[model samples]
Target: MFQETVQVLERLLRSPSQIAKHCAADEDPRALFLASLCATLLGAAAFGGVLATSRGGLQLLYSATKVPLALVITLVLVVPALHGLAASLGQPLRLSAVVSLVLAATGRAALVLLALSPVVWLALDRGIGYHSSVLLAAACYALAGLSALGLLWHGVGKSLRGAFVIACFGLVLVPTGAQTAWLLRPFIGRPAQARVPFLRHRESSFADAMYLSALSSQGIYRAPEPNSHPAPRGATNLADDAEEAP
Candidate 1:
């Protein structure tokens, strides 16, 4: 099993074209899903470990749930929406092919995250601020995700009109994942309240929160001035909603 897992991962990383071709050739979708699951779990575990470094052990536990939740939520919305869109356009696709494509993309993302674990750990250990660290980690994930999406487009073929579908899918998946992450707060640090709340009332929209954070000097939002820098590296400002970002 271990050997097979290693070989699958190697193919994913080293020769994605081969995997795509294999899938195109009608490889078993279950095997692809299983391999993707293993890859994603390993990546999530690495991320959880990094979270454990700064956040408490409890955070490590919470972090474990994030990826699976995000994946499930995004898929639930994306799969149906995409199928509907494809159908409306008179281009119905195989569910199995779509499933295999998404899993392949996710598996690639997981591997990418696993590779980034070390850098994240180092940045956290070096005392990067909570907000900065989280954003950086997210950026890493975003890059990985975009790469995976690119692979999806390439592997699935342009004739499938994958680019359009992926764009629509991304529009739904990204924000849903973000909001879901927001709901499952404090994965990166201690909560402001003494007790952890499962679902806090959303005071502001995600866009507003982002806008406000950008307007402020604290969050990812930055002004046009080149001289203006973000919060000091490694600054801990837990007073700000630590739960804002994933």
Candidate 2:
């Protein structure tokens, strides 16, 4: 019944006014089933892929309810698309085609989920903690896998393969982004080392001055500051200057 309904929906979405002319709005129960199934399968495949490959603190969340998350996305996105396909197929909602395809697609979705199962282990293998730099990969892979799964089930429906691949590419972006962010983090809080080039030179000099002044204050040197020159801005240098002068 669900499969039959989806076929009708596929026709309806493909060509809505035509379907409306012949079929009542509430005509098919199978349509709802197919819609729900597509949603479930695609959503599961999408999120499950992420759970399977992602490492880091977020892995826990991704892994825990990945299928359900996939299920939700399927309901929200995939089903509507299927409905659109049905509305335009130019045929009566055929039960056999609907059933066969839905079953095939759902089976593929399950396979994708299975394929995605390695994420947590893979992440841990890399020695990264969850919720750290690697979490984005997991999230991205999951989303990508769903699109891929949809394309696979639908047999190259409207750039599905490309879209899926693009989503997977999105995973690539996360790690690169994380590494870039990590590399650039020092500049954000930089205590001399991360300072801008010109600022780094000034900060380095200030650090050296501060270090010398501290040593002198601890009686580790004759003077951290020169008695002949005005004391530097650091408080430790002022003390050293007075001590050396007197």
Candidate 3:
């Protein structure tokens, strides 16, 4: 089982086409599914834990658990949309095939994240600022997302229609995945925060937070209004503190 799982992870990076083909046509996909799922869980958990190293403590566990949970939940929620988009784009696939393809793609992305974990840890250890670190993490996610999209593109046929299907699927995927991660925020707790929280109070959408972060990265900060209620003690603007620690 361990060897098979390792092979699945290798193929995900080295031979995405072979994985795509297996997902599409294998008579018995149980092995493939199990291997990919294991890869997804392990890879995401490792990356998540590394992300928490900046703030350290119980936050490590919180980020590790929440990251995989966010990815799995995002996968579950978006698979049906992917299926419908594929069919609408004139490339219908069996539901099981779609599931396998999506799982494999996610596993591929998770592996990319795992590969990036060390870099993230080293950057934090070197004393990168909080907002800069947030941008760095976003960049890592972009790379991992591209890896996942490559496999999905192959699964859908690597043509104009396939591109359309994947593009539409991405429209569903990016927002859903971001919001899911947003809801499960604080993967990297703030350095100044005294307590870790399992979840943060809802503030703004993921897009808004990211926008604020981008502006903040450019040295533009949103000043608090005099009449506005003060944010909670540990809570800081998404741009200023990124995600609060749990």
Q: Rank order by lDDT, top first?
A: 3, 1, 2
lDDT of 3 by residue, 1-246 (tens): 778777777888999999999989956777778877887899889988998898899999999999888889988998899889998889999899999999999888888989999999999999987888888888888788888999999998999999989988888888888888888888988778899999876655677677778788788988533333244544345565354221
Candidate 2 structure, TM-score to reference: 0.31
Cα RMSD for predicted model 1: 6.6
Among these predictions, the greatest lDDT belongs to 3
- Runs in model 1 deviating more than 4 A are 86-91, 159-161, 191-203, 215-239, 242-246
TM-score of 3: 0.92
Question: Of models 1 and 3, which has the larger lDDT?
Answer: 3
Which 10 consecutive residues of model 1 have the lowest summed lDDT?
224-233
* Candidate 3 Cα misplacement greater than 4 A, ranges: 224-238, 244-246
Q: Distance from true position, residue 80, model 3, in Å?
A: 0.4
List model 2 lDDT by residue over 1-246, tens digit each.
Answer: 656656654543354233332322344444544553564455444444344343224333333344444333332334334334443543223433333343334433343444444653465357553223133333433444453344323332335543453344334433332332222211111112222221111222223333454555455654443543342455433323220000
Against the unseen true structure, what C-alpha lDDT does each candidate score? 0.63, 0.37, 0.82
